[model samples]
Target: MEAAHGTSHFLRDGVVMLGFALGFVLLFRRLGLGATLGYLVAGVVIGPQVLGLIGDAESMIGFAELGIVLLLFIVGLELAPARLWAMKREILGLGLVQVALCGIALTAAIGLATNFSWAAAVALGMPLALSSTAQVLPMLQSAGRLKTPFGERAFSILLFQDLSIIAMITVVAALSRNPADAGGPPGWQLALMTLAAIAGLIIAGRFLVRPLFRLIGGLGEREMFIVAALFTIAACAGTMELLGLSTALGAFLAGVMLADTPYRHELETDVEPFRSILLGLFFLAVGMMLDLQAIADRPVFVAVAAIGLIAIKASVIGGIAMIIGMGWRNALALGLLLSQGGEFGFVMFAQAQAGLLISPEAASLFGAVVTLSMASTPFLMMLTAPLRRAAQSTEQREEPNNDGAGALVIGYGRFGQTVAQMLMLSDIRVTLIDIDTEMIDVAGTFGSKVYFGDGTRIDLLRQAGAADAEALLFCLDGAQLDAGVLGAVREAFPRPKIFVRAFDRRTLIDLRDAPHDFAVREVMESAVTMARAALEMLGENLQDIDAAEQEYRRNDDERLDAQRAAGDYGAAREMVISHQTELAARARLRIPGRPTNRTGAGR
Candidate 1:
């Protein structure tokens, strides 16, 4: 009877979580909001206080553990030595100063105002100094600000925070003051164990990980790769535990060592599902820890603490951003970006609890501060546009008038460069901008007028003769995004003819419906080429291929026109399903009896 009741409770918990996750994802999409925020909200809704779905969060902590491990590994993969070196000034210099300043200032203030001891205040401040990378990065990517200077600065600072968490772990472990316990391992023993463990991790990661990857690669099974990644994570985490250090520190070290691998990105991709699930679980577990009834009893205090934490963090970050020469608007944007107490805060606070570094009440206060501040970031980012526009209204702006009269090619890839080269051969000038610096350097040696930067940036577009250009060619890879770029072009240079390339059916639909003058797919060009070759082999005259090409162009244009009128690909795909037979019959009629190469007969 007891066993059956336990199983039933477990089943109910799983069902509730599943329902919450489904509804959460669906609502996020429906509302056009970030899924992270949606997940957080889902946790709140299904929390013990709200729905009493997840009655015991302790069972989910193991899953949360896996999430942090995978997340740190992925973070390490992104932080290759070269990239880390590139941002050293910001990460080590500005980042270090900011963390120290914020921690000291906030801790002192809390100690002075409240009856909290210095140790308790320091514990509170330590966690609050960190910022949420999971939240900020996704938000920046969605806003198309990830490649901006401010974004780069934010990323550097976040990386520093991640690295700094290891220090926090060591400090918390060392300073642990249990009332019942007299002492821990000797200081030298602790130091040696930490060093040896770190050394062991480096040796294993450097020697073991690559060969393991090679073996996994040889298996030619994706599941094997995932298994290997999990094994490595667990092994490292277990090793750290044996050495009396936090599993996070071990996982982070493992990641840092594997950062230089060619397979790092692939590893990241493989582990992404596990990372995402774990991260969601972590957030849910955090939500479950919220003492809602307690908060309800002390609503004013919790609310004040949440609000005060955000305000203090924002003010400090804003001050630093301004001192670093960011404009008021940019400072405000960055301030909000850095205002949150991150996932590490939860980890640190949990550690503090285990070590008896803080009382239960203090830990709860820390949790409230972290959750409320993190929850407010999306809303804060929403204010960026208005704040920026307001700043622009009062500032004098310099608009560039194009000095070079040319065709502006936004991407200098194979397709884009070919178009630019062809135009140049015919004495038409061309200017290009690409985000890859190496590509630009190589293109420059060939006398190509190439600039290195993201094409979506208005400033880069303007410098690339956007206004004075005769035509704009959007021949980049990932051309579905061209529709959005076209909108920007229309706003900047509405009169220019926009020539674009579509990769497939979906992109074709996107481009067809987009407000642009010319939209062509590589499929059309390849089809024309194949037709020309077939004509040569069949002893057909030049006029035949030309006529066939013209017919193909006409057919594609007509298809696009019809699809655009329908406003979505579903209707167009249905149109294809309904008319494929009729189109094939029309092609057979157009081809004189039987076509030699049926593949090239029509698009």
Candidate 2:
């Protein structure tokens, strides 16, 4: 009866939590506020201080930490050894500098503001120095800037922070003083334990994990594969915890080792749902942990501390970015994006509380401040958008525009260069327009005349001879920019034949619906070439491969046209599958001696 009651309670709590989380996230998403903020809001509403939905914040936190563990593991899987090695300079140099500077600065400020021992203040500073990888990376990805310079730099710093968590955990363990036992393991013993755990994880990952996974994969059971993956994460995390090391560290090491494996993408797909759910729970737990009473009592202090923390961190990060030679816009964006205390701060604070390193009153207040800072990050990013744009504008204004040619090509980057090269080879007297001055200068060095200006602007387009231009070609840097240029050109000129370069299938679909005569996908030709080469390597005749390629293109075009006409991607995808099945059937019926060449006549 007791066991049954416990099970029932668990189910009820799970349902309540899920229901609240979904509602909050959906509403917040509808308002364009983001799901992270929504999760935090949900936690606050359902917390003990408000509705008293969950009585045990600590229990929820423990479960939510699994989300972070899995998150770091996924992060590790994305970073192959070669990629990590390539960013070593930024990770160590810029990352360490940011941490040290922030820690020292924050330590001094906290020491002056409150009455706390230097050790405690320093411990607090450590967590505060770290930025939210969970928050920043996704935001950058959603904005389609993860491949941009700023995003890369921000990622480098975040990677360094994740690695530095091991050191931070070690420090916290060393500071730990058990109330029941005065003579616990010494600092050196703790350090040895940490080192031994790390070594054990490495050895196990290198020797044990890959072969085990391969064995499981050979069974060809997806359920078993998922089970094995989970077991790996749990075993690694548990082993590290037993060794008095960070569980996240162990999971991360395991992920890094498995990064180069063939099963990496499969592992990611299997683990993503659990990670996302748990991560949301973790954020919700953070919200619940907020000390509402303390905030009410000292609202002014709480507000000021949150604002001050953001200001200090942003300044430090921005300064470091500039010192590391980042452009003003990128530096500022990096700063704003990283100006919040990370989820790890809560973990460290909890550990400190358990170790009796910090007083309950101080911990409560600090936790509230951290939560407030995190909650305010999305708003801060929104505020900094205009400044980033202004910085870009200032940088663009400094570039010189010399002369115009007969044909003006927008965007002189990789795609634009290819178009320009092809046109110039034909002696078409092509002129290039680009926002990036560096690219313009590089083109000039290569004896190609280029103009620096925003192609989306009508005035700039006219200055570059849009009125008398033979044709308009867009190979813009991003999808958003391409769409903007397409809209402007269509509205202003309407007569010139417009050609666009699409980076992906989605972009191709979007452009198909636009007023453009020609939409060439950047990767199609290369992909087809590679496919044809593979076929030739497999002993297929070159003529048959060419015929196959032509048929594939024709079918793809018909499928895309049907998809656009129906306005349903699902149906279009099904049509593609059905078409492919028919092709396979036809290939199977072909005579053994003679080759079959079936072609769709429509262009």
TM-scores vs. true structure, each candidate = 0.65, 0.66
Q: What tens digits encode model 2's per-residue C-alpha lDDT throughout 1-603?
A: 999999999999889888999999999878656788889899989999999998787788898999999988888887766567877888889889988888888888888987877778877888888888888887876775555556677888898888788788888878877574356676668888888887888789889987777666656566877798888899888998876667887788778778866556567767888999999999998888888998899898888888888889999999988887877777887888899988888878877776678987778788888888877888877888798766645543211121224467887888888888898787776657765545555666777656544566675675445755667888886674455567778778765678887877667666655777788877888889898988778677876776677767877888878766766665566646464565673475451223343223321
lDDT top scorer: 2
Highest TM-score, which number?
2
Instruction: Write the residue-wise lDDT of candidate 1 on 1-603 in tens digits.
Output: 999998998888878876787788678747655566676677778877787777777668666867888888778777878677878898898788778887877888778878877777777787788888888887776765555567777888888888888777767766777754356675346667787888878987878886676555555565776788778878888889876687887777777776765455456656777888888778777777777766777888777877777788888888998898888887887877789888888778888887787877777777876887887776776667699556445544322222344687777888888888898898776767665445655776786645444566454565445766778887777643656766777888875687877777568776554678876776767777886897788776676567666665666566677777786666544334234644564475465443536658643
User: Predicted candidate 1: what Cα RMSD to the true structure?
Assistant: 11.0
Q: List per-prediction Cα lDDT, in the order shown.
A: 0.73, 0.77
TM-score of 1: 0.65
- As for model 2, its CA RMSD to the true structure in angstroms is 14.4
Worst 10 residues of 1 by lDDT: 395-404
